[model samples]
Target: IMHLPFRGRLKLLVASLTAIILLTWLYLLAGNLENGRSLLLSPCLSETPEARVLERVVLESRVREMEEENRQIRLQLNQLQGTVGQPADGGNYGNAAWGASADTGPEDVENTAEERANHTECPRSPTILKCELIHVACVCAGHNASRDVVTLVKSILFHRRNPLHFHFITDAVANQILSSLFQSWMVPSVQVSFYDADELKSEVSWIPNKHYSGIYGLMKLTLTKALPSDLTKVIVLDTDITFATDIAELWAIFRKFTDKQVIGLVENQSDWYLGNLWKNHKPWPALGRGFNTGVILLYLERLRRIGWEQMWRLTAERELMSMLSTSLADQDIFNAFIKQNPVLVHQLPCFWNVQLSDHTRSEQCYTEVSDLKVIHWNSPKKLRVKNKHVEFFRNLYLTFLEYDGNLLRRELFGCPSQATSESVRLQGALEELDEDDQCYDFRRERITVHRVHLYFLQYEYTPAGDDTDVTLVAQLSMDRLQMLEAICKHWEGPISLALYMSDAEAQQFLRYAQASEVLKNRKNVGYHIVYKEGQFYPVNLVRNVALRNANTPYVFLADVDFLPMYGLYDYLRHFLSILQLGCNVTKCYVKKSRVLNTFQKHCMQSSSKLLLTHLYTSLSPCRPRYHVWTKGHAPTNYAKWRTATTPYKVEWEADFEPYVVVKRDCPEYDQRFVGFGWNKVSHIMELDAQEYDLMVLPNAFMIHMPHAPSFDISKFRSSPGYRYCLQTLKEEFHQDLSRKYGAAALKYLTAQRNI
Candidate 1:
């Protein structure tokens, strides 16, 4: 510390302070660099895999944030550089600029201000993107049209997340309802405006009114004048159409149009134009090039240039209109215009506008449902359709309407006031009326039957059933008379022994039955012999014959060798008697039932429906081989039988062809399955397709009698022709099912089973 002058000391102090400040700055910069490095390596030292994953997710989120910021910056830069296109009318239409932009003059700002004032009352989204807004137009002139509009609007809103402006060309009443609906829904990113249909009608007065098409058709022609001049393009849709995908995706079609193309539309699915317009004359070069107007993309700017008045003049020309199909009306006009100037029209994919007029044509045009963006119920309105395909579309329409503040309240809830009052009145009247007068009108009701069958006698052994009597339809041979006699002696129930064989074999069976004391002495038993000449067993044919010939309203199609357990016939008759009163019986099977060894003498002597039921009830809750029958078995309550039942067409039950108790009216067994493969299962599947309910009885069981193997394994293995025939028959059954129900029906059946 040297003593220095005061000025020197002050200068030294200032210099020292400056040096410390610089050092502090350097240290801070180094510390920040070290912190950055540590942060970069922290993920590597994460204590657990979850921490590392979380760190990566955070980094990804940050990266996305930065990318979005960068995009915004670029957009701002482009806007400042004047790359966004200006509106042709020099007004701000609130549409995002995409094309090149130009410098705005004072006049432009003034015009924009004026336009904004005019649309100040119109609702708009505060956070809409700076992109071109989609303009959509629809006509609402009648109650049906109004309802359709509500559904269409809801569908669009459900699928579209982009900003749009909906222009509704409608009457005053519809406009009010639409406005109220939009307000109630609190829809976002959408601005709705109404244009009077009467205005368009007045403008196009020169065009003659056609019964084939209403004034709604003329409203579409006025889009060039009806819409604001600022709108460059618009998507015109029919009220009857519903959107399945984003409206923005359909709006993108406008970009695909060439410079010369003014409209984009899907081709007409039907040949109405070719058949009606081009008939009895040399068809035009574009005869089949007609387009449907259900979904149309109009280039409003181009239409303005072409002059809407000019189009109206063409429509007014009686001779020109006469040349086109009167039935087609406006569609014919559009086709004629496109024919003359094909360059003006752009053909779109058929899926964009799936016209639901002819199902065959629609199926041929759009093969996959995923490809459909919009469904147009054109010919038969959705409300009037009865076909399944049309019904599906109708359901979608109703669902959308329901979503839109229950627009279908009357249809779905049935006018609450009237329904409630009527129901209360009916209840009161019924209480006062006598029960005897409450007769049901069952004349129009038809019973649906579920069919099932049993395959038996593959090993050739007699079954024991001293307490049960059931119709035993057996495919007989000359050697099986002893087996039949034994079965007849054991079973105490009525028997319809159906024998399917050659004429000689049938005669032999009849002679044997006549001679056997067991069969002839039993007054309840009868024999039906059907002569079938073939090496292959026509089991299904004989089963069908037995089913038809059986006198009982309820029939059990079982093999001759099957033995009904002790209480099986008693329980079955009880169940059937109740079923005949009201229930529609489809399929019935026993619980915990199995095929026992034919050589086991003790099993046949001791086994009965009662013993089986007791054994099943005593066992643990483990699943049995045939668990469906015993699943819901309550010995005392018959109504609980349904609990043990499952859908007959389920995957697990695909091969479970047990003895089925079916009503007489069930569809006959398929006779094409001449051999063992699919004879029983095919009939069960057909019944399942008919949507019949099935039942399972746990208390009543039947033991299948073991028989010799009917199919010769060695022969089948060596014979390719036999295997091929089996495969061919299966394929034919599949083809028949497809032709009747549809190719998707089989797929749906499999899917249902998996679920």
Candidate 2:
């Protein structure tokens, strides 16, 4: 029987005995754990001291080897599972799902998101009337995590057939983005609520888990507490995965769960739990193969009835005595509990998870499955996974990654009484158009006017007033986006950028943003789009849009043409802090806790001046109000400002057009003023009327870079009708301010003849 030398044969025999003894102990450990007894107390080991010592040596050796392997694979495991200890920027975590081609097999599977989302392929059920929601939940953290979450929601929306409710456990940044995103999409049948993960952190903070995802990953275990008590069932998902089929079908499995079965999970498709990855591999014990926690269907009421918290907590405590800290966090504990309480688990079909890890043996799952339901690239390599069929999955995921999120906004099926979606309304109106009309401009005017599509949902949120952060809020046309890099560099703070342009310009700007180094990578910038829907530019409307969306307490409302002097942003924050100025201290809520915000101008005592370039001197000043314009600039008294070390108040002058940092709730610009003349003048006048200090800052500078005139400015100079309308609007504005404040509004200005 021995082909090898005598020593080699002896070594092989020794190794075989070692494997047998290890497996035997493992078998006893698994059985003993099920009976709530440690392997140390097993009768097979005997009550003898020698057997106890042997058992200790074997078990200790196993745990040490496993820990070493875990340390080596922690990073790889985190990426594979779609969760990371640190928040990645735009592209780190892969947001994709494997899409195996359609194979002929048995059909009629059902899954989708219903009840809280607007679905187009509405099932003939009374989902809308009965409000039968397919409630889904996700645990998300980090700044760019929303990118994956967005794709996950898109997949749900893509296959959903009824009303859906989304429950999100998120940090502040994620909550801000998701709340704003869903609000802007305005999907009729969908509703989403956010629970702060930070608030739930204390629930799991006591657990000593060393999983690569850290405590954020443990948030899943606290789902029964984090979610509302009324939420009886929820389909929990990780951010890295996307559903290839209807999620309603997955939700349908909850009805299939037995009274004792509280959690539905897919088995680990890889041979990981079989201890075959390596001879020394001693992963957490699982039944047959382990259970993956990436996608879970929880029967919340059942879990609570079974005292899930106490049961799992006791389980974690017991495992921790020997394992120290879990290697897989929630997944490990879940499997450990399932091992002890087998009846509590309901296994879902492998098609639902479709795990695509490097060591995956999920190919057996592909046999006769009609459609690839949920393709989990549960590997760090993602699209570059070792699988030969990865390209097909890559292409399918890219389709959704580059998808136009705007297209997902469709009319809610089963809600006939509600207003139609833009597509439906536009399609209906287009039928009324002349058959000969093929011109782009004619169709745009008729179709686009029916939809109010100005929104900027692309933003990250940190809770307001977490610090004394100032945001530069500015408005510009798409032509001026090239100036974004310079301004973003010099200003050195977050920004709220609002643009008024055509739809084509918006698309062009998006492409430019993706290609540009600064625009693409920067997470602090928020883009608000207002396409050119009207003839003359609504300059005030654009300004108001930027100001309203600025999350910071202080907003430096400047024209896009101007760049703040370097370090002016930090300087303002410093000056404001010294003066104890708030962003006007408004009350807002963060998970029911109060947050305070302040305005910038409320504390404008920086040791700097609001400096402007010589662009004014270079340009022709042949307008009718030349003296008033020059006099407004002259009021700063630069003669003293040049040597001054502190701020001095400047009496508000008519036509001043001041560029100042103000609070969140600053005066709104007059909507009545369109095109060029008196647009800024009316806003400054309103600020004066409201008594916000117009202080002259020393050493601070606002440089007006040279730029071509806007379309409205060019029109104002040539068209007499445009000039006439401007004059009339100015007259009415002055008259109205005079009526409201009864001449006190004019108190701040040096009165002059009408232009």
Candidate 3:
């Protein structure tokens, strides 16, 4: 039942041929008869035994050929039917999570949706577990839609009290962007899926206009086709709308719906629907003022049963016949359909969808309503819309945009002081992956530590920012606490520190932190402890612990032994905020040499390091010591860095372990590199494999406080077997990366060899 013409006709051909073949066989089995009730069994009896056998064999061969033809035709029919799968239970999803089937063909999208109208047997993922989820759908087709979608979703999460499911009708670019965001969020209440917008638009030869993605907006009408048919009801929204109250209250309105009302909406406050916005202005036909499609409570099941596909398409083609393209936007199509079928539309309160366009007489709704439940920026001008009270709505949106979603976390723990380690549950329980696969065996053998005790203790509790987006993340051993205050003082932002220590060492550190002027009672710094259970230091595990716990939008992954330069935190924030949404950062941090080998340059925020420089034309007191420079830092290009004011790109993704100020959603550290050697290298290599652009920030620098090598490093250096194991592990890692990336892995090999 796809919109495939040839396939439909081919099915008809098969049915007609089958009927004709049966009739021919029936006639051949009987002798010819002229009169009614005459005997007709003479054909088989008149034939000799050998002749009968030969005739039967001939018929069997012909039948076999016809069956083969039928089989080939059936295969072609199947090729036309692509995936339309449903979401599983609202909890824990793997590769086949949400409503998206892992097996859905990317290339098999149709021009116009046929929806397999009579498909009584809906396909669902066998692995999906079912639980209740509040379904929400959005049409996020273009670039800016992702940003708007984030704020829209953020507002929902901030206000909702139930588990959420999102069905995004999006393009390839937006899908990748939102996917990374969703993964990083890890909100237990949220689930997201992507449907191909390009797939639905693939065969369309023309469009209404470039703005509003033309008919892409109208694609919401195809929700039954785009989303899981099993999802009976959903609230569809525009990315530009923000809810000001608990979504549960809005959801409860469904109880007020009559049996015939399939779609719920708020009537338009704009005079455009009345054809009075401009002189000679003509608008789409509607019952009184048209209803806004920005906030919709769609009854998907009722829509499917009502022949929504045929009704909408026929209505759309009829409307478009007289015009070149639609100007009223996608809402025009909905308004047109609802004009004639008023029984199917349910009117919601105007407060649920308060409009803010100049053409809209929005003040009328404001006067009638006591509260603003939802705000819609339906105009193309958005914030610049000509409404009397636009500033209030604009600020409301900006508040949600700047809101730190971390504070909305569902989990809150209150551990009593008397609870002993044995009595308390372990934080971040390790998954016992089956060792049946060689890859799984390799990981288990290499990983010596697993438990991540997040926020084991806190010296102070600090909010994310008055308005900031960066969190500094570092990992260290108990012995390396010398510059904790210096680093904390240097960066006046949130810092998440992961330390490898015993229970006693953690208590000692917290007591010490409490007593210090710079560190004591500092609300901005979070301490996570990974207890050393007599195992070689799991440095990457510690790094992952800190990175995962960072609750800010951006994180600066530096070493605990390093101090950031003055103005670097604010500069990094300013730099990231202006970066066209801080996209595709490959070189997120500047690579600076160790302070032990170079001049010690500190922050102006606390104190500055005075240094005597050798030959430098610039005013910088800090300079790189070429004579004592470490290996693998040649990629940082210190010579270019000395004079360049602009950021530079590092061609290699691996080997160059530069400090990074990356988004909190970055790829996690490869925990397989438990000790020290390739932990950071493997992370950057994976980033490179994902094709992220690495750039070296010009002003950012992490002044490393050089110290004696750790016990793990000493062991790695002194023991030959340990070195051999690390080498074998490195090779194994490369092999796995090769298998995952195929020929792309060869480029990494080339880069590694060059390094």
Candidate 4:
């Protein structure tokens, strides 16, 4: 037999009493209890009128009053018995064991309170909190353990006595985790109905527990049909909750709403989140907030009137679970229900189930909510902080909260002293920092340095005997000259082509660059150039221009104000040898220029006079005006060139490995000549990677002259233009040598034939 509680039994009794009273009254009024089928009768019989009619009426009234009193007493007895204990075997009826029935005398009615007090000692039923079902159905899913649900059950039975009966619904069939917990938390008064839905499976079976087979829903439908005619509502809850306190408080919120509305917890509204829900095919009202049925209060009559249970069964059979699974089964159905009929849902504070993240950014995130009746924790994030102190404090707070009563008295400062020893240590450190009036240094406690952080200082020196007025091609702005000229002076390399701004203008550019913020922290290498209109320096022209401005016997095409990192003397010696060598060598060029408005400046190799002569039949002279720079195409077979390198090969991270480059200037000065523009290093790198035999001096790498100063060409022309004189000499030599060698060889051959 399906067991219904006292409420259901009372409903049946009341119906039966009403029916009997009506029939008997009608029969007596019709003067006959039998054969009065045609007319409804009252219990006022004329045949027995002479037989003390007035007395009988008085007796009937007394009997009715007595019956009413008896019913009231029975209700009280049943309530007391239910609170103290569950009915033994078949419900608490039939036997006169626990309490009295209508047949019992007034004595039993008098002792009902005494009986209730006595039964209260039968274990369970500690603090009685009133409860009424709000949501009739809820589903808990996910394959993970649901320990919170077990705790929730314990709180309901032992603490609050709310849900008279609960239907534990899940797609998981007897999940060991949830099953074990349920058994452990089972109490006397609350009945747990478990429905195993192992039979229901779907094709898209990724979801572990699926109720798409309609078995669980059908089972609930059966239960609803067999409901002992008492319960007007049902409630459903998910398993992912921690019930640290009574749930009666949550249920009471729903009870205030009338049966016309289905009440649930409100999910905070945000358009972004709602849009995603709409995409997921969940029924979210376009106009208002959505609800989370984590705890739901449902009205059964409303559902029955709409045939909701049958409709759920139909949808389940039609294989609609896949589309609905995005929001999960229970959520989807609840959302649909709300959309169809707008319901009243309310939101609880986040403390009810606060979602914790990596650092817990919420206000008062670290502070434990003393009034937090439940928490979701979300995931394992709370346990993963590196600060041991924070973790210790968090653990202590959670532990204290897990148990009953306040362990630490609150201070006037709103701080609690009850904490773990580890937490205390951390707190002490924090207090020290606070007292010192300083902020905690997070970096000092957590950072470390290694070998990669080491740096080498490049020292520079120049011999005192060296010439002070030696012309050095330095492309520099005035500020850089200040930083680098002392070293240039020490090296006896006089500034020749100082391509730069005056000190004041350079200072202004420096301030402007700093204010722009892009180049503020970087080294201003000074040779950075931006061409004006009509100033295209086709690589070769720019080099010729810089070289043309020089008046020294030997010029090093250098950048503005860049001091060689170190080993400058050795580099110059090597360079001198290479200059003496004419054209029998190859080298790389390093183009060091910052991004300008759009275009890039050309190379160091562009200015190499010997290389230019060897590669180009026609050469252009550097004009003071209207001349552009050009970089010559790299010579074929140059890729095979090799060089010897220094301890630190200046060409770093190139495709080539470092090899020593013979210092032609220092030893074999007759094998090479000076090259110019910026790409000279590139050529050297190309040859270096190919492992060529031609010596490339890797030591004492050049410190490029940055934007060397412009000269008054008029004054340069007035001086005995050394560059022009050299070009004239080259032209004279080529003409004289070709004539002399060819004519002599022809004359000698003709004489030998005549002989």
Query: For each candidate, what TM-score against the reference?
Result: 0.36, 0.62, 0.46, 0.28
- Give a tens-digit lDDT track for model 1, residues 1-755: 25988888989999999889856644443334331232433545666786455455555655576679968976775563232122222212211111221333455445445544455434442332334577899877643466457568768877765666899988765665566445433333566789988878876555555534466676777788888999999999988788888888777666645565687777676655555534474322232436788999999898788775586456447435454333444565666666555556666767778777753256545446766789888875455643446666767776675462322222212211223343355446556544453211110011111111111111112333331223444445454556766665555555565565543454355456568776657655544444343355566766775676455555676666555555555566665555445433432432212111111222355454444334434442211223333421222232332233421222224444555666656788887666545676677667656654444544444444655656634445677766666656666676787688775448535633553
- The Cα local distance difference test for each model comes to 0.55, 0.66, 0.65, 0.36
Model 1 worst lDDT window (10 residues): 441-450
Query: Which 10-residue window in model 4 sums to the lowest lDDT?
Result: 448-457
Superior by TM-score: candidate 1 or candidate 4: 1
lDDT of 2 by residue, 1-755 (tens): 37899999999999999999977866676445422346545586557897666556656766676679867775564474342112122111111011111221122011111211233344332222333677888988755566567767877887777677889999876776677667656565787889999999988888777776789889999999988998899999988787787787788777655455688888787777778898887777675577888899999998999899999999988987877787778898898888776656777766778788787866655554355788886787777877656776777676666555556667556554234365467668777767664332223342443112323334654754545577888888877878898887787688888887654565577678878887777777887766465466677777777788888877777777766666887788887675554233442221110111111221223223322212222332321124434644555565555566777777766676767777777788886666677777788778777766667666566555656667777887898867775666666677788888876866533363533
The model with the greatest TM-score is 2
Q: Give the lDDT ranking, best first.
A: 2, 3, 1, 4
Tens-digit lDDT string for candidate 4 (78-155): 574343222231111111132344344565445544434454324332232343332333333332223234334433
Candidate 1 local lDDT, residue 269: 68
Ranking 2 against 3 by TM-score, winner:
2
- Estimate the TM-score for candidate 4: 0.28
lDDT of 1 at 147: 43
Q: Write the per-residue lDDT of candidate 3 for residues 1-755, one digit (tens) a residue.
A: 35659988799889899889856755654333232111433566537795466446555655676679968864663442111111121111111121123322332112001222222344442221122357889988544576577678878888776667799988765675576556545555566788998777742334364344676766777787888878898899989889888676666666545566688887778766778877987887876677888899988899999998788878878888875566766688788988767656667767888888766766655453338889998777888988767778778887886565545545312211222232232222225555464344335534343333455443344555433478889998778877788887778888899887764565577668768988865667877666564356777878887888787877888878767777677887787666635545653453321111122333222222222222223433343323443443456665565555677776664466667766677888877776658887788777777766667665556554667777878877797867776767777788888999898888777766766
- Model 2 alpha-carbon drift over 4 Å, by segment: 1-131, 258-260, 362-364, 367-370, 377-382, 387-389, 402-407, 416-471, 475-482, 493-554, 570-656, 663-665, 669-681, 706-753
Better of 1 and 3 by lDDT: 3
